[model samples]
Target: MDCRRSRTNDPDQWIATCPEGSKAVCEELRDLIFRWEPDLKESVNSNMLCFSQKKRVCGISGFKNHAQLTFYRGSELPDPARLFNHGQENASIHSIDLPDGLEGLNLRALRSLLHAAVKVDTEPTQPKPPAAPREEWPMPEVLAAALKKNKAAAAFYEQLKPTYQREYKVWVGMAKQPDTIARRLEETVRALAAGKKWAQRKEG
Candidate 1:
């Protein structure tokens, strides 16, 4: 199915369009989920079609060249092969990358695994261990005073890698609650200035 033009029966859900082979794989998995876990709910949250309970259990998406089945609580699941590459450690998100040529294989095993996974509790996730303490980025002094208290902003800043650190100074500095924003701006600043991600970073 071409998901770009498709919408789900529910106003909140939109079926996604991915590579042709990926579409088939997705449908197979979706059907199998219905067969195995009939009571599971489906909807779109954060603009992605998701299978969820409480938080989210899983999400399905199609992408260029390939597609992915995302487990929001991946780190909590058993992955003996360690195939997922989530760009950070101790995070729950992971993906099973689908390449071409493996299409049409009975996806029963995969579906069953996911159904079982939905039952596994994903909580008790450990905090991301700290990065080796490095010199705080040379933020402007005026910028520092402005930033000291906001938790979310500070969290954002810390997560950013060095390359994306500057956008924050510009964005937060302009806000009226420059300090609050600065404090809350950590994540954004780190993302913009350091070329890194807050979520990808293990949140302590």
Candidate 2:
């Protein structure tokens, strides 16, 4: 099914577009969410059925062979049941894959997860403290000498902001091998002469 065929606000219409293997599981998960948190506002965003209150609490996405239930602030929720099977490395988002059509599903554990998610959404969140400024990387001697020889590169490098200058410094300074440092230094000078930022440099 072409999930991106159209935007849908109706739950039934959205579920109808899910892959055949995952449709039933997705529907059941949707019902479970609504039953547990009747106050959550439902909407389809980016082809995913999302539930939100003060903020987006959770969402349901259907894939080829499985349905996924995602918690927006899942990193903050307790999952003693170990039901979450995906996105462990993510900072905030986490999800559970419901394969095999919900067979052997743990309803009690799932309910606990849902309840915790809703509670997190309802609670007021504290503003995050400002991040500490990153220490600048020292300029590599090879790059400094190269810049000194090329007037155009030196002029361009000098005009760049500290953030952009740090990019070239970190890239060249990170190379431990002498050959690697020489190669990166060559690339750095060429990029700077062409007025390209470190990220904008073309790979050979």
Candidate 3:
């Protein structure tokens, strides 16, 4: 999925880009959301179709395996039909995942859920606290020790913009296999020592 925020605000463009089966499901849900509340404003955020009424109420996104309807403040809503199956432990959000080829969604129940979410957004609420400043990615011990051993590399890394630093961190952090992580860590150290961005390294 594209992690970069989309410049396009057109929800249809976002929905049309989904995989075959997911496209239909995404469009269906997107339509339902709008029909449920004509006043709800739609926008694309973080590569998903997000609906807001003064604040974000929900978002829908299509993935390879499923399309998810995520209620921004779903943790507080009642789920008598138990439609939500994910993010239950979260403090603010809850979600329902619709796998492709699944039977039709329970429209009656979904409408009720949407109504409840809308109500929450409409009600008076305490002002949220200001968000904290973004922190640097947590460096793995191996990476840290390597940088410490090379003062030039450490200085170069410290001078990188947060975005570049995040790219390197995500590249290493996403390695699922131990061998892959080890290899990436080694390559990362080499790149930093040479003052090269992660993307500038030759593909292995």
Candidate with best TM-score? 2
List candidate 2 stretches off by more than 4 Å. 1-6, 126-204
- Tens digits of per-residue lDDT, candidate 2, 130-157, equal 6789987998888899999999999999
Show the lowest summed lDDT stretch of 10 residues, model 2: 1-10
Clash totals for all candidate models: 20, 0, 0
**TM-score of model 2 (CA atoms):** 0.62
Query: Which candidate wins on lDDT?
Result: 2
Instruction: Give the Cα error of residue 182 in candidate 2, in Å.
Output: 9.8
Tens-digit per-residue lDDT, 21-70, candidate 3: 57788888888988998889998998888999989999987777678889
lDDT of 1 by residue, 76-192 (tens): 676654445442354567767666523653465566557656776344545655678655445665557534654555555667666555544544555566676656455554443
Q: After superposition, which runs of candidate 3 have C-alpha atoms over 4 Å from their true positions?
A: 1-4, 101-104, 125-204
Between candidates 1 and 2, the one scoring higher on lDDT is 2
Q: Global CA lDDT of candidate 1, please?
A: 0.57
Instruction: State the TM-score for model 3.
Output: 0.57
